[model samples]
Target: MAKADNIFNIRGRLGDFIFCQRNGKTYVKRYSGGFTKAATQNHPNIKVGQERFAQVSRYVKSLKQQLQPYLWRQKDGTFHNQLMALFLQIAKNETEKTFNELIHELDSYSSLSNKSLNKNSKIDPSTLLYDAKTNKLNLGIIPYELAVKYKDMYLEVATGWYGVDGEDILLSKPNIQYIKLDKQTKNEDVIVDITPAEESQTQLPFVALAVVYTDDKGSESPHLVHTVMACFVKMRNI
Candidate 1:
């Protein structure tokens, strides 16, 4: 798919092309329609590839929906396709690493946001404390020095607890907080209570932080915002 910049802002289908919207931008892609059963049977590789891609796409969609609040208007039109490609790469060598192992590796890096402020915003592993009795997870506190450096911006912190139960991906409503990035702003510990509906309470916790810039009048600036995945902890029974 390619970014479309037409003045009319077209969407839907027209002949062999399909136009769509993502992140408030238009994108166009070729749509060749479908193939018959005989066509698919003659080319087994094509059929297998289609099934694999469909499975990965479903997983990506579920994860995307879980992180919708964090995504906001932060990504470009190509983000969806780019994410799909990344997951495809992870699924390439199934023999070397189990699918679950590959999924767990996502904790090692930021899958969605850029890593520009990763070094500064990263949470210490020791600070990510989970208490089974309270059913709460402590995601750590922001450094005063970092807040002082970007006093003009707003700090947005988000933490999520994720788990996989068979085909279903269990996700708790993300705990989010926004703090005024003033030097005098009190740096409190970021904590979240995860009370999932499912019986299995095991989950892997992930945290992300974003800096949002705005003018004196309190109007937000889209181009000046930056986000990063701060930390992700190992799976445990919470």
Candidate 2:
């Protein structure tokens, strides 16, 4: 016959604890902790060391959630522009490269495109493309009024692309309107009531808000899209 010993002891400092188990002739350290003390202490019969394990598990889960958006953005073009700037130093001497080759290289370097980023979102790219193609191209170096108008349309499409419902994703207050008094003088003001939707509980989760504009002609040139994703929220109202 074998004697059975079942005793669990927790030994540690105020902020931490360790669990030890005694089984007949042998003693074993069961768990260590920093995060799981509350959840573990809730169930006493479980091994001393086991409670802390749950805390570590939960921490890892939280970390993964936090990193998900960043990981997705990285696959897009968030860092590509910086890398391209650095690559310019090395490629400066390689002028012998064909134009098509350079284009291919740049495309390969940044595999992410705005379209790919918004593929799962609610906005449709075809509409934006049509607007860009049909709109008269202003040859001026600076963005013209029409260009800004088109940019606004693009932003609306991008907002809708996220597929979030309601007016949760709103253009920042006061749509900016620029008026030119002369060649060098311009005035800017906010436009109101452009969108009638109010901030409400039923509003879709606002993943991001953006302001996009262009400095070049309405070609396939890069346009800025300020994107924001919903993660943190203030607890005042809800």
Candidate 3:
């Protein structure tokens, strides 16, 4: 048989059952009542031929296949492994009615999907909580990867437009009076003066939050992309 023919041949094992690689898809072979083939990489069906244990990757892939395609918009596949548990739970509880409603809202009402929302999340000023007693801005989720890459991260007064929900920020606007996340504890990101209206609009202050992502070499980068989110406490004037 040609290499292509082998792909469709049942020659591999998946738990107690046998699996065939057909057109890049895996199917479990059945022979209980008669010869048959059923989809693998799906829940209970994945165990059709055995009860021992399936490979972890198969289990995870099965979970992934169970979700509606629209839910894949939740992440840009960046946090796949990290979100497996949550994804499985959501898929387990999903109903056709609820799933379709979510799709409709995402299409008609929401401007950004979860993936885009994560890209430029609003930084909560509280992430840089200032401890009145300690006299320091308690860094809740500062860019640890940035510190690892640049050696340290410092807060500087700078101008950046941020949202109240911590999911969006307008970087195009000129400095609007806010703190900055700097390369070093010395270089300031910069903060400009704010108008009374701008000050009143400061519901949640944003900070440059850092995150690590796979680099070109398929290895985790030492440096991180600075993102923003909301603070737990209300914005206040110092």
List per-candidate RMSD values in Å. Answer: 15.1, 20.7, 15.7
What candidate 3 gets wrong by more than 4 Å, as runs, is: 1-35, 38-78, 81-85, 96-98, 103-152, 155-208, 211-222, 225-238
Weakest ten-residue segment in model 3 by summed lDDT: 108-117
Per-candidate clashes, comma-separated:
0, 9, 17
| lDDT, candidate 3, 57-144, per-residue tens | 3444542343222122233344345334433333334433332232223132122212222333333342344332332334444433
Q: Which ten residues in a row have the lowest lDDT in candidate 1?
A: 112-121
lDDT of 1 at 17: 94
Runs off by more than 4 Å, candidate 2: 1-187, 198-238
For all candidates in order, the CA lDDT equals 0.57, 0.28, 0.32
Clashes of 1: 0
The candidate scoring highest on TM-score is 1
